[model samples]
Structures are given as C-alpha cells and as structure tokens.
Target: MFSTVENYWIKGTPKEQLMDCLTAYKKENLLTLAENQLMPMKKSHTKSKIATALAEQLRHNFKITVDQLTETERHILTAYASGNLPEELTEPQQAAQATLVAIGYVYLFKENQQITPIVPKELAEQLLENESEKDTDNWFLTTKTTVETIYGRCELSHLVTAWNQHASQPITMSEAAKFV
Candidate 1:
C-alpha cells in the first residue's frame, strides 16, 4: 500500500490523519523520530500503536510537544498558524521545513510539479487554536483606549503593529528593533 500523505490517509479527524501519516512511516524511521527529537515515549511495538499513543498524548499537550522543536521550526509553525507565511519558502524557510519533516511535525507532499509543505492537520488545528486564545483584539482595544486618553485620538496603525510584534513573539529589545 503505497500512497502519498495528502491522499486518502483517511479523511477523518486531524488526529486520525496524523496517526495515519505516522503509521505510513517505516518502523525504523518512526523509531528514530521518537527517540531522536519529536517525542519521549515508552518503548512500544507496532506502527499504529505508537502513532495512536503519540497522537492522543499530543492532543492535550501540544505546547509542550512543540517545545521539542527548534526555535526556527517553532517560528515557521507559528508563522503558518498565524496565516502570515509566504506561499513560497526562502532558503532558510526550506531548511526549517526540512527540520520539521525530520521531527515529524511536517511532511513534503509532491503533486503536479509542486512540492508543498504540509503540517499535519492535527498540529495545525492545535497551533491555530492556541494562537486564537491570545485575546489579541481585547488587548489591543485596551491599549488603544489608554493611548487615546493620553494622546487625544492619534492614528494607531503603527501602535497596532508594535503591539502585534511584541505580543506575537518573545523577542529581545534588539530583535524587536529589527522588525521596526
């Protein structure tokens, strides 16, 4: 049974699909992935067993799971989650994506002459859900009100951008300056 990841992999819940993709991996590869980077789990046999176990565990602890990835990989995943990443990746983006694949958070799917980076739907859902939990609009509104009280109704697009930069990432002062 040979099939690409984006294909059948059972159009089910994100977790189910992720389990399918992990199951598709050869046993050796899955073993390497589990041991080397993506997760820490009890020893196990059988493809479906390991995948199912990891998926269930990951669903509740996605933030912890993501912490296992590198900073660039986490940034790429977050960028994707926030709907801000470009469709075409740059060199560094490609390298980060390759690392994601190796860590089992992403897959490269080729079809019709294009290679697309595919984060497991399960992981994407979790990441986007976490991002939405930020209550960003409420925070922005509070900041906007405070600024208007002090400055008497100035434009705030720049302020909004500043808030977004500070809120979306945990960057140092210098790194924040670079974005500006």
Candidate 2:
C-alpha cells in the first residue's frame, strides 16, 4: 500500500526506490480492487489478467516475486489506483495513509502533478498545481525536497509520531496532536 511505502519513505528510503516500489504497488492494488469489485458480479476471471499484468510489471520493474509483498502493500495499491481507501488499515497505517494523502499521492486516474499540503486538498488548487509536475513514465516520482518539505511541517510529523507513540490506543488527529 502507498501508506506502507510512504512510511518507509518518510522514514528515509530513497525517493527513487519509493517511487519504484510504490508505482508497482499501486498498479498491483488496482488489479486487486478491480477483482474485488467484479468478483461478486461473477467476473472474477479478469483478476487473472490483472495478476498477469502485475507479474509483468513486477518482473520488469521491482525484480521480485509478487508473493513477497505485504497485505497492506497489496491493498493500498488497489485502493489508491482505484481512488478509494480500504476499510481495514489500522491507526498506524492511517498515519502513513495521512502522510500519503497529505502529499497528494492518494488521488488518481493518473498521478497528480502537484505537491500536496498538510491537509492535501485544503490549499488553493493553482498554488498546489504550480509547485510540481507528474512524471508520467513513473507515476510515483517524488523528490527529496518534497520529503524535506513534508518533514518541515511539524504538524505532519507530530501526527505520525503521535500515532507511532500510541500504536495501541485509538486516538484521533486532534487528540494525537495534543498528546504529541
């Protein structure tokens, strides 16, 4: 999932690798989401195609078996590419999810060409649009500057750190901020 990948990236994985893994992961998630959507309608056969496409992409890009991926990785990819969130991700997962959401990586028909704000859609569209560009060949491309920008926002890091701090408790953003 983008959240897990973002968590790893936020913790300091290189952007290129984050983008690489996240891009692959996003596509894979789309396939699974599509499978879920269609399965109950008796169109489950399409999942095979989705899997094949994922395999090829994995082979060409990540250089690993699809089996090596975690459940969050798989689910987030599906949810993101499909422009939705799964009901499952827990609180810590939500912290990563919020980070990704804040960075404007959560919406798509294609990658957004803007660097998101602390609250993502809260900023003026033109301002956000003026700040970045989507790298079409790789939908997940993000810069170190962007990561640094994210870090500069204590509110964001505090939010994640709060989640990290209370990995066991059910805390909302407002409560987490106060505690942090």
Candidate 3:
C-alpha cells in the first residue's frame, strides 16, 4: 500500500524532499519521527490515516503532486465518492476496488457477510470539488461477481489437488482408528 503511494511521491520529487516534508509535518504536529526516516510515529496508526494525512500535507503545504492514480482508480474513487458503485462487483473490479481500499482512498465494511465500500468524507469532498469540471459520467461500468464464489472455487481446486497428491498414501485402519 505504501509502495503505491511511495511510487507517486518519488515521481514528483526527490527522496530527500519527501523526507523533509514528512519531517516538517511531524514536527508541526508534535509527532515523533519514524526511525531512519521522516514519517510520523506509526504505532497504532492505520495506513489510510497515515497516507491521507501525508498526502493532504504534501499537497496543501509543499504543493507536491501526490495523486498519481490511474484513470481507472480515479473513476472508481469518483463512483465511490458519489456512492454509485454497484453493490456487487466482478472479480477484476473487486481486485481493483481492493487496491483502492488498500491505498487509503476508500474503506470497506463487512455486514452480514457482505462487504461494502465507504469513501472517507474529506476525500469525497475534495474529489468532488477538484474533479467537478470533468465529466465523470464518462466512466465505464463493468459486470461483477461475488468474492465468496471465487474463494470457494479456489479452495475447492486446492483441496482437489491436495487430495489427488496424497490419495495414493494410504493410512492403515489401525492408525485411522487411533485418531478416532
């Protein structure tokens, strides 16, 4: 997750500049600096919280270009901000959505075994205001399938393979009976 944001950060500035920005932010907030670098103390901190704070500070204070998100990611974020994504998603869409969740742009909630996306209030507001000039409806929608079925199929396949691999190694009835 940090890798994704780090890539974006490095693209826009030198490593030293990034570290300096984090250091200044940490000092301004009275937060301890991370070991060997300039990140704030991360104990008990969520990645989304850290990323959002860092990104906001970098953009607002340093005028750093931090949002290097792909067009697909941007659209997914937009839909998430507008609360317009379909309730269910296809495997590929889910994977992409998972990336968004991982990168701190969105969040997920599980209720009654169903997972849903929840966009952060501040992020949604910023995106809406910043992207207002663009035509968001041009974003494409794709078909979706539930994650449970995908996991089920994957587990079934692995079980079948394991069973086939060990099928020839028979255990004696006495050994089986010992466990029983």
Highest TM-score scorer: 1
Candidate 3 global TM-score: 0.42
Whole-model lDDT per candidate: 0.61, 0.37, 0.45
TM-score of each: 0.57, 0.21, 0.42
Itemize residue pairs with steric clashes in candidate 1: none
lDDT winner among the candidates? 1
Candidate 3, clashing residue pairs? Answer: 89-144, 89-145, 90-144, 90-145
Q: Please list the residue runs of candidate 3 whose C-alpha ends up more than 4 Å from where it truly belongs after superposition.
A: 2-67, 135-180
Model 2 TM-score is 0.21
lDDT for model 2, please.
0.37
Tens digits of lDDT, candidate 2, 1-180: 233433222222223322333343344454443343232222343444554443344334321322343556434543443336455668756664554342333322223432211211312232233222222112112322355477753444544454456555344555434432
**Ten-residue region with minimum lDDT total, candidate 3:** 136-145
Tens digits of lDDT, candidate 1, 66-173: 867777778898776554657777787767766666556765544465554556677888887765544554555666678889989845555646665677654344
Worst 10 residues of 2 by lDDT: 132-141
* lDDT of model number 3: 0.45
lDDT of 3 by residue, 7-105 (tens): 222112212222233332323132322221255555567544554556565335221121566656677778877879776666666566656644444
What are the clash counts of all predictions, listed in order? Answer: 0, 5, 4
Off by over 4 Å in 2: 1-59, 63-65, 86-89, 95-180
